[model samples]
Structures are given as structure tokens and as C-alpha cells.
Target: MSDKEIVEPLIPASGSQKIDSATKRGRIQMILLLLVCAAPVIASYFTFYVIKPAGGKANIGELVSPVQPFPSNVIEENLVGKWTLLVARPASECKVGDDACVTLLHVMRQLRTAMGKERTRVQLVWLVTDDSVIDPEIAKSYDKELAGFTFIRMPRDLAKKQRLMTWLNADNEQSAIHLLDPRGDRMMRFKTGEGHLDFKKMVKDLEKLLKWNPTGKVGD
Candidate 1:
């Protein structure tokens, strides 16, 4: 019998193995992109929350825990482009019965003026929570006094109004002024009593926020 040399055949990887490797590479790339995009947001949170300046207090306005989303159904604009000062009060509060709104509006206007050249970058929004039409005289007063104010209507139902109110925290029934970052996250609020709105404190707080956050773009 003739002697035959023994030989072994080389085997190539299965198609499934090549596909799995490609999928893994794609997933890694996606994860890296997500991290890159999210780095700034994470850093901002760290700087604002975890890192603190020695001997200095945080912002004057009460910072809302776990920032709330802006109610888009009320304001169609993204509201993310400029620092927004939101005045949230029910229209019923504005009925001829309530006189506090006058002082509230005045305080809000002064707060904006205190911003100096930065005023244009700050958007003032008045969120009315009831379906009741604003009294004509009051509407005209707003037009004449509060220039460039954005008026919006909140949900009419009491329950729905409560849900929207959850966006900002307040201790009492009195009207409150809220601050929204350029990104439109409800961040802080300034509560006020009948006629005792503190314009100076609010001004100081806003100046500090502007100095820290700035406009242009996030992290710029």
C-alpha cells in the first residue's frame, strides 16, 4: 500500500461571527458619540450642584430640584434660546378683586431693567392659569407698562393647573416669579406676598445667574 500524507483543511470564521463583530463596533461608536454629546450637560450639573464656591451662597432664587420641563402646550416657542423670567399666577387672582398683580408686574419690569444690556437676552413671560379673559383695562395696562411681555394661558382645569404649577415650587398661594435657564428648565422661583415683592434680591440673583450662565450658547 502506498503511503499517503495526512493533511488538515483550514476553516474560516462563520458569517455570524463577522456580523457580531461589526455590531459590537457600531455599538461602541454610538456609545462614544452619546458620551461626547452628554459631557457638557453632566459637567454643568456638577458645576451648579456638586461644586460650590467657598464662603459664597448659591443663587438667590430657590433652585427647583430636578428641573422641570417647560409646558409646551402653553408656549409653543422652545423658550430655550434666552433666559426666561416666568410670572405664574392664576387669572382669577387678577380679577378686580386682587390688587397684588399690579405690584407683581411692576416688580417683574424692574427686575428686567436691572439686567442692564442683558435685558434683551432675558425673556419675560406671564403665565395666566385661568380661562377667564383678562380685564380690558388690565390688558391695556400690561400693554402700556410691560413692554415685550409674553402672555400665555395655562390649563383651565384646576387639576391640570396644579400639574403645571408643579413645575415650580412655592410655599404659599401668593404669586411667584420663576426663572428658567436658556434651556427652558424651570430652575428657580421667587415667592412674594401681597405687596412685598423683593425686586433687589431678584435682581441680584438674576445678575449672578447671567454672570455664571451667560447667553450665546451653553458652555460658551
Candidate 2:
């Protein structure tokens, strides 16, 4: 054989491998696209990183901060189009007598209605943290709340670690609705001092967080 032919005969033949190459190239393109799409979100947050909500209370759960997404912790999963939390705490120790249940309904209604377009995707999730068979009357109150929410019960130990509750002193606290973004992380606190969780000042900050995870797009 000629020197070139002899060398070629010893070497392995190469296949087209077009599909493999295309898949790698496509993956790179997808990654780049995600980065491009997220650029605006980064810029907005960075620009307003120091800016707070219009009023007071601008911190974004700095006290509780974010949980950094450990698998051991529980996250509010998206249900239907709504994202909700089955708070392992109760709304109040007060009996659900008179029009209290109805009033609670109104509060929940307002909260949901306030979300407007997001209403369809967010809800109140009242979770009883006990194995006791709830009586029919108490169950009725739960059902009433469910009308405005996605209510259920879970073991206190398991549900209490949902992260948000850790921020709120739930030792004998009330069940407060949590506001969650499309992603499953607990990015804000809704059940704060009086009325609702204080976010008027941090609304823009939250708006940024909702759009982008503080962690990098791929790793953060």
C-alpha cells in the first residue's frame, strides 16, 4: 500500500455525526436564548436594587431571606393555575362563630381579587397541622376558606418547615395567605404585621425577584 493509504487503513473511519453536533449546538443556542431573555429582568432589578417600594416596608423578607432551595425544605407547589401554601398554622384561636368565617372569606376574596390577572394563579391555602379528625363544623369553616383557596391539612412538623412560616411567629399565629411567583420558591412574606404583609415599599423589588431567581439562571 502507498504510505498515505497504509496510514489511512490503520486509522479509524469517521462518521458524519451531524445529529450529535447539531444537538450540542442547539443546546448552546437554548442556553444563550435563556440568558438573553433574562437580561432585562437582571437590568431592572439591578437598577432598582437599592430602590424600595413606594411607601415604607421595602425589605424583601430580609429577616427570613430566601431558603436557598434545599430539597429538605417544602416549597409551595403550583396548583391548577394558582400557587398556594398549606400553612401548617391556624388563622386564629377565636371560634369561627357569628360572621367571622364570612369575614375571613371577604379578606381572602379581596386578596385574590386584588391580584387581578394573577388571581387565577394565586390562592389561599389553609392547612391544619394535626391528625385529629376535624369535626363537621370546623370542616365547614375549612371548606368555606377553600372556596377562596386551596385548603388542606398536613403534619405540623412537615408543613411548618415550609420557610414562610419560619419568618412568622406561628407559635399560636393565624393562617395568612402567601404570595408566590410562578416559580415554586417562597420569595415574599404575605402575613406580616397588621392587614397584609408589608410589600408596598418592596413591590418593585418583588417584581424583580418574581421575574428572576437571585441564583443564576442556570445555577443560581
The C-alpha lDDT values of all candidates are 0.66, 0.45
Q: Please give the range of 10 consecutive residues that has the lowest summed lDDT in model 1.
A: 211-220
**Distance (Å) between predicted and true CA of 96, model 1?**
6.8
* Candidate 1, residue 144: lDDT: 24
Clashing pairs in 1: none
lDDT by residue for model 2 over 37-82, one digit each (tens)?
Answer: 6553444344345443334434544322332221223435333233
Q: After superposition, how far is residue 44 of candidate 2 from its true place, in Å?
A: 9.7
Best by lDDT: 1
